[model samples]
Target: MSVRRTVTVSITPEQDALLCAFLASGRYRSISEVMRSALRLLERDEAATLTAMRRPVAHDEASRG
Candidate 1:
């Protein structure tokens, strides 16, 4: 089963208008879809950051024995 979540946040006037225009154009069915896309990108970027943090250097550096 997919977990459903809700978030409440704020945006600037220009940001709000831009999102409203996107919804009005029917490009996105709902505000949730727009937020989901933004969050998904955040998740991917976060994962990349975590992986890089864990592996600071490659094995080539370890081979200098």
Candidate 2:
């Protein structure tokens, strides 16, 4: 079974309206799906950022001599 959490957020009226449209169009089963997709996108972006940050240093860089 899948569990869920409650997350509250604020956004511009325009953004909220857009989400409503998505729901009304049946593009998503619930507002939760929209949020889930957004969070997954953020997770992917964060992982990419961490990987880039851990990339090897330049050849000119060296430890204290």
Candidate 3:
């Protein structure tokens, strides 16, 4: 089992409407599910960004001859 943490977030009215719309579509069971999925995607993107930043540039590698 995974541990869960409670967090407080503030969203704009538009964001709240969007979430409500998503819920109405029956795609997500709750706002928490939507947020969790979004956070997971964000984490994936951030990790990818960090990995890209740490990678050696092709031009720099060629200049080391």
Best-fitting candidate, scored by lDDT: 3
Candidate 2: TM-score? 0.67
What value does the lDDT take at residue 51 in candidate 1? 92
RMSD of each: 3.5, 3.7, 1.9
Whole-model lDDT, model 1: 0.88
Tens-digit lDDT string for candidate 2 (2-65) = 8877878899999899889889998898888888888899999999999988987665366532
Off by over 4 Å in 3: 60-65
Which one wins by TM-score: 1 or 2?
2
Tens digit per residue, CA lDDT, model 1, 1-65: 79997778999999999889889998899999888887899999999999998885767678874
Error of 1 at 14 (Å): 3.0
Model 2: weakest 10-residue lDDT segment is: 56-65
Clashing pairs in 2: none
RMSD of 1: 3.5
Candidate 2 residue spans exceeding 4 A from truth = 57-65
lDDT score of residue 17 within candidate 3: 99
Estimate TM-scores for all models.
Answer: 0.63, 0.67, 0.80
Q: Write the per-residue lDDT of candidate 3 for residues 5-52, one digit (tens) a residue.
A: 889999999999999998999999999999988989999999999999
Full-model lDDT, candidate 2: 0.86
Compared to the true structure, candidate 1 yields what TM-score?
0.63
lDDT scores in order: 0.88, 0.86, 0.95
